[model samples]
Target: MSPKNLSALNKTHKLLLNKLKDKRTRQIYNKFEKYLNINENFAVAVSGGPDSLALSFLAKIYSIKNLLNVKYFIIDHKLRNNSTLEAKNVQKQLKKFSINLNILKWNGIKPKKNIQSIARDKRYELLLNETKKFKIKNILLGHHLDDLFENFFIRILRGSGLNGLISLDKKTQNNNINIIRPLLNFEKKDLTYISKFIFGFFVEDPSNEDDKFKRVKIRSFLKKLETEGLDKKKFLLTINNLKFSNETIKFYTKKNLLENTYFSEKKKLIILKESFFHHSAEVIFRSFTDVIKIVGKKYYPVRGKKIDSIIQLINNKSYFKVTLGGCVIKKVNQTVIVSKE
Candidate 1:
């Protein structure tokens, strides 16, 4: 490393290690290290919450121990009047521990509907831009076990399929940037413990208590279920089982793409032979979804219902052309053609 970078990293090392003297912090750090097991330089998205604050400390230790550079960022969506102030306060608190943070602002008009979802998308857009600026491939997030349960119930309520039910894996990639959640197995209480012991402060977002949001409502429902008879460990086992099933489907999906679909890279198109539809509906469904995502150059797959309609049309051996998810699907003779629109 250059002398300039080395000096800066040294400062960061001293600031984080000084706070790591606590036994609880060290214990959590060891667990985090085991889960992460990474030596590459990375970036972290901090929200000033206990979860994110705990993540920042753990990531700092990992970076210092591995001699890798890490940058911290706070996305100031400015949705609330005190959002920027809260971001600055969090920044000041981290600086005392030797961690510097940059606040990324969401500029321009904000969405009136789906406020939470839109804000989240904007936050990721800002964070991904930083990842490109630093040439970092991994961005750490602080989603704990409670969040895992919350997301599961949310997907269930939304009538999501198997994939969506278990989408929040430990490691997921989006738009070429890896989103790593190392704390998924840990509880929220543990993260809160870490933040209190290490920084002695953490910000609480009011939206978490707001019942108007679907997630908050689901969280409340989960609490009721727990009071009645929600065995968290058993519930987690169910999720693991579902994940295994999802993985099996993914395996076949890849196989179908490789064996049945022919791609013309030069033309940015895919040819789906009759044999492609020979597999089960589930396998073919996932395969088509993958093809559409690849051809359409979209990070997210097309909706399940829309994909189902296309599959039905193809199964009937009908000649039709339809555009969905930025891909145009046309039937010619016994073959199907999919190309970017």
Candidate 2:
């Protein structure tokens, strides 16, 4: 490394450390420190929003303190005009702090309907691909408490079951990659403050305010409820209760799979004894979902409704074969067999 470049890097570090002397930044860092304990090199996805920009700073500081390397990436969906320019501007902003932000562009045709959902999936795909290229296992996201609350209400409106209701956790796996959301416990206000204090700006996505999106609608509805004196503390308590119940179901579901199912590694098949269906309905549903995902080799699990239908048919003692989520399932008298379709 050249001495000149090393000097600039030292300046960047000193600047960031100096910012931490600010009481507010220090407080946010302390709260952030309490949550993230990752010692391994990781990646952070930056969206140029307050939450993500704040995440870049906190994560950079974390990597610096732990002496671990971290990569920063942003997805350029190109859904709007001047998005490339915006991405470049964000890249420059991070470069000032010695954090190189890589932009991954979505090149295919964009969906007309379900734009947000497809964009989110593609964003993850792009980020995961970059992580794989770098041989990194974990990626940090900037979903804060507001997103968590909005997600719960959104899932409820979709008539999601127990597992779906609390699916978003601090840590989740997708496509064999670990997704870490370290800011779920922090509110948006704090993240916004950090972003402004550190970067002096953040890009506002217009889609956030557009009511056409379910998440936007839920965000608005939550504000209305807040006006009606809804207590976030109370709402958080409710979510915690639901999470506890979800954990219990997950526990039994694991037990059922361990005790009542056998997998043939060479044949890539799963055999489910009838006892697997004897657990509680939720446990059985969860167990079946896990098995189908494994046998199907799909990143996403099969639709819950379809999985429920298959389970119902198998429990009714029907001898039939059906295909779902790239998996073929059939019952043979006393056992259910699942294999790749």
Best by lDDT, which number? 2
lDDT by residue for model 2 over 160-264, one digit each (tens)?
987777777998887678899999889899999999999999999999989888899899999999999999888888888999988888888989999999999
- Candidate 1: C-alpha RMSD after superposition: 2.6
lDDT of each: 0.89, 0.90
Give the root-mean-square deviation of each candidate in angstroms.
2.6, 1.8
lDDT of 2 at 70: 93
Residue lDDT tens for model 1, 134-239: 8999999999899999999888887888898987899977767889999998888889998998889999889999999999999899889999999989999999
Q: Give the CA lDDT, 0 to 100, for residue 97 in model 1.
A: 66
Q: Model 1 scores what on Cα lDDT?
A: 0.89
Models 1 onward score TM values of: 0.90, 0.94
Give per-residue lDDT, candidate 1, residue 104: 96
Off by over 4 Å in 2: 264-267, 297-300
